[model samples]
Target: MKQSLLEVKGLRVAFGDKEVVHGIDFQIDQGEKLALVGESGSGKTVTALSLLRLAQNADVTGVANFAGEEGGAARDLLALPESKLRGIRGKEIAMIFQEPMTALNALYPVGDQIAEVLELHQALSARAAHEAAVQLLADTGIPEPARRARAFPHQLSGGQRQRAMIAMALACRPRLLLADEPTTALDVTVRAQILDLLTDLQRRYGMAVLLITHDLNLVRRFADRVAVMENGHLIEHGAVATVFDAPRHPYTRKLIDSRPQRDVAPVTARQAEPVLAAKSLRVIYPVPRPGFAGWFRKGEFVAVRGADFRIAPGETLGVVGESGSGKSTLALAALGLLKHQGELDVAGRRWNAGGASDRALRRVMQVVFQDPFSSLSPRMTVEQIVGEGLTVHAPELDAAARRTRSLDVLGQVGLTEAQFPALLDRYPHEFSGGQRQRLAVARALIVDPKLLVLDEPTSALDVTIQKQVLGLLQRLQRERGLSYLLITHDVEVIRAMAHQVIVMKDGAILESGPVGQVLDAPGHPYTQKLVAAALAD
Candidate 1:
């Protein structure tokens, strides 16, 4: 039998007095891919970080044995001397962090960063290491690697930055890779590409990977074995097929069953005039053409072209597509944020009417942005944030009235002074991600908008929290008879929330039909691919 590459036993992690991870045991065979699956704060991350002795401000104990080094004695990473561990870190075991934009150095070129790893571990000169860096990027299926190598972290796309991160982690040809939610921030197509890249590279290097992620679909596609964690305790571990097919632990079952569920009320008032309507809507942008210094003569890029859609008074019209598929542009056009060359109206009034009328009409349609923490002002209190809309939309209401209205809407979104002490005076940063999203909904709903545009509302959240938020939105829609212009790439989310759905690709609407019909039997090839790429694990 092959020797285990890593054997972790009695692993425990704590932050001060609170122990996040309890004693747990697991092992990975040579070239095996094992996934540590759980939601946020599950201690999977700290477990991996503890192996490398990288967990900060926390006490980590127990044994993490590594046998990656050839002809050398196996080392207990938790007990290894700092100096010796540093030598073995990038050489034998390397890590690919979750967020590449923050994980990578913004000041230096991606190639230089990758080369730095080679210089430290492989003892390669700067020039040779840099050349190797470009090759590694190309191996990861990045186009024009030499050019992309020179670009900074922010300059590259999400997928490219992740690939570059992978290249740097593999620069020293480590025997084990610790990847933490590597594709969480990426689109489905890009996430698939990165998984394929990792699979290929892992086979080539004969490396074992400890993948720490909450995405079960990714685990199904990539991992050979799985370990489930809950509230920092390892509850179950087994072959991927066995565990996923028939989860023994209730927590594992809960995680698997947490896929978005459809509970939305069917549209019975389809004949009613739509809260929002658009026909032949087109949004075009001017860009500088390549070569000949065409800055003087720009090229035209059509972001959304000839789109037609309508959301009934109490129905949802979902726009589904991948990144750069013009879904968001269509959303912007619907919101009256972008100029369009077509017939579009909100509550029977055309956009860009100018002055008080336009501002007042805009209140009929409100938007809940993707990221709530960023969308909400940090300095403002919860009452201030939610009631700010009332100031503009209902100026006649005094401060007391605004506060009353704010509390009412907040209650609709599931926030209450009962749960959160001094809730009104609290700031945005104090709330959890799911709670923050709820606050965003309350802010949009306060003005009593007829149409709510939910833009990837739950994508940033994990499955459990995502389920909660989707439930909240579903309840809100049913109770208030709210019309929604939901823009998202998540097929499950569309199935759960939308009544009517439109599939878009490259600024063109490829298919339009009911959510059940489009999802269950996709006519378009692109739509089929998107649905197929959903959460199968």
Candidate 2:
């Protein structure tokens, strides 16, 4: 067997008085890829962070032995001094965090940030470090590396920012790379590209990878071995294929089987009226003109160009695309939140630019945003959140009636007073991600809307929770006859929730048809590529 690059024995972590990660053991061999898979709150991330002692306010114990370079003496990372640990951090071991936007320094240029790592760890000259940063960016498939190097973290797209983070992590050529849900926030195509880049770089540098993620598809595609974690325990560990093919643990099997399922039966008749309809819709924003032309006229950036689609009552229409593809713009237009140039009708009424009619239209159309944690107010209680829509649509109702309505709606979304005694008084932060998303759904449903615009509704959820939420949505649609305009980058979500589908790219529709036709046998090259990438993962 190959020599172990890093080995952990009886690891444990506790935050304050709560023990989060119990004693667990695993090892990564030289130049190998190991995936730690689990759902949120399963202690996957906590376990990884314990290796580097990065989790704040947490107490860590047990041995994390790392084989030093050139057959030097192996060091117990858990017992290392802070001074020595600092030396080993970026040089001997590096980490790529989950969210690049927050992980990177917003005030500094991304290139300078990478250069700083090289200077600290590799002790290179300023000029040499800067040059190396640019080269590293280019190696990670970033375009216009020199120009991009000078750009701040906010200036780059999500994919570009992630590439910059990767460049910084690899600057010192560490022996082990700790990637924590590295592609979780990325678009599907960008995710595939990042995975390919990591795989290529791992092969070239001959480094071991400890990938922490809940995405089983990613583990199947990228990892050589898999270690399954569930509620702070190591439930299973073996070769990737062996564990995936014959998972001994129920949690592991559940994770592998958690792919979204299509439960909404096809509508046979066309009896219901269209809840939303759009014809040749166009949305444009005025961008600053570059060069001398800025003195005269602003440039027109078309966000949604002549897109046409419709959603009937109780039917679901999915819009799939990458970031900056204008799918969210279309959702905004459909919700009457944005001004558009073509014919867009909701509940047989057109948007009236914040007039009395527009206020009425708001009652007929409600939206559930992508991230429930941010979308839901932290200061607001569950009762306040679910009942706020009633203030606008049913202002005449008394406080007691509003409370009753809120409770009823909450029950409809699978939350009840029986489940939690203080359900209404609880805040968003008090709930888990899945519970928060259900609350978001309840808030949207409380308005008695005919149509719901779901923007990446399940993108932020774990696979199992995603399945549950989709099931809730399906049940709600079937029972309430509500229509949905689902916007997301996940093909599985689209397949599970949508009856009809439209594939978008660069503010234009490349393909539109029944979900079966569009996704299974996509005619457009872009759609084909998307399908292939989803299947590959």
Candidate 3:
């Protein structure tokens, strides 16, 4: 058999006596595709980062051996010097981080950034590097490579940016590629395309890939070998077929079961009164650029065009769409965040799209955003963070009452006051990603808004946490009579929560009906395509 390209043995990582990774071991053979699977805070990402010596402000100890010319070279990757490591980083090893928006340079044009990688590592000239970058873009299946090359990170859609990032990573022709949840932000179709691209590239280049992700389905489809991590421990590792077919670990079994059933039980007509309504909602963003005549030509780019939907009291209305399908635009507009034209009625009270104040609307509706870290303020403590809405809307409550109420809400979201008291004093950085998201949910719920817009609220969480949050949301709705406008691409999540489903494409509604009807017997061809893509195993 061929020698292993990368072998990690007895890998351990610690933070201030808190050991997160406990002597986990794995190997990636030449041209091998390996997956590290686990929930959040599970040493999967740390183990992957350790390969490139990229664990910042953490004590990592591991034996990492890379194949050499004759036999192989075994070295303590953690002890490698900064100078020696620089030569190995991009030239021999490349990484595609989870969040492309955070990983890619937001300020630079996508093509120029790709060109920079080639210029630094490959020693290519300026024009040659640009051409190589374009070719790489084309290779990644990006449409209109020429026009896309000049687009900034923000200008491109989520999937396009991810492809651009992958293009840059492959530009160096590295021996190993570390992909950390590379498809987390993409839709089903885009994910299939990216996975296909990665598999094809790996076959062509014969590069060892260490894929770190929480997506078990993706691991099943792509990985040759699999490793499971939990709370910093490697619980199981084996061939993909063996591990997935008959898992020894209970964690693995739970994950497999968590894979949402493609078909949902039939939906009964919601009996509650309608709590939120949007009539002919339109959100248009103005894009102004100099024309051929050097004059600024303003064009109206319709994001959410004439959207209409209603959410019954204690019901969830799922908005399904691809990236830039205006799902989020509709969510923001519903919350009165964006300048839009629409008739919005919450709890039977008519509200103007532009003139209504957030504080006035707070009593009727609230929003939970996709990213917890960015949505939450890092400066304030959890108490102040959650209570800020209360202080604004219900000014009669004193500081002590607000603190008590905040503690109650936090506890309600599966967090304890004892575990979270420090959170109130410290900033957002002090908490883990899951805990931070729980705090975000607490903030939204403390206000007791009748309507909640869950904008990919569970997108960042692992499956177990997602289920827990979904259950909590159901409970909250049941108790508080809360209505939800749930915007997400997770079809499983839509199946679990949505009473009614709306299929959207190109800023317009393609189909709208009960969730079961849409998922089982989609009328439109586009909806059928989405259903097939989403359910493809």
Query: Which candidate gets the maximum TM-score versus the true structure?
Result: 3
lDDT of 2 by residue, 377-419 (tens): 9999999999999998999999999999999999998899999
Candidate 1 — worst ten consecutive residues by lDDT sum? 184-193
After superposing candidate 3 on the true structure, give the runs of residues whose Cα lies further than 4 Å from its correct spot: 69-76, 134-148, 260-273, 349-358
lDDT of 2 at 67: 97
Each model's TM-score, in the order given? Answer: 0.84, 0.89, 0.92
Order candidates by lDDT, high to low: 2, 1, 3
lDDT of 3 by residue, 1-537 (tens): 967788788888888888989998788899999998888888788787877778887888878877763465655566789887887787788998876777888889999999999999989998999999999989877777987898899887666788888898888988899998888777787788889988888898888889988788899899999988888998989999999999999998987677543322232435555777889988998765556633646777898878888887667899988876888888877876788887877776766533435457766788887778778877788888999999888899999999899888888888885665565676777776677788888899898888889988887777777777788787777777677899988888898888899988889999999888998899999898888988883
Return the clash pairs for model 2, or none.
none
Reference-based lDDT, residue 38, model 3: 85
Clashes of each: 0, 0, 0
Candidate 3 structure lDDT: 0.82
Considering lDDT, which of the candidate structures 2 and 3 is the better prediction for this target? 2
Supply the global lDDT for candidate 1: 0.86
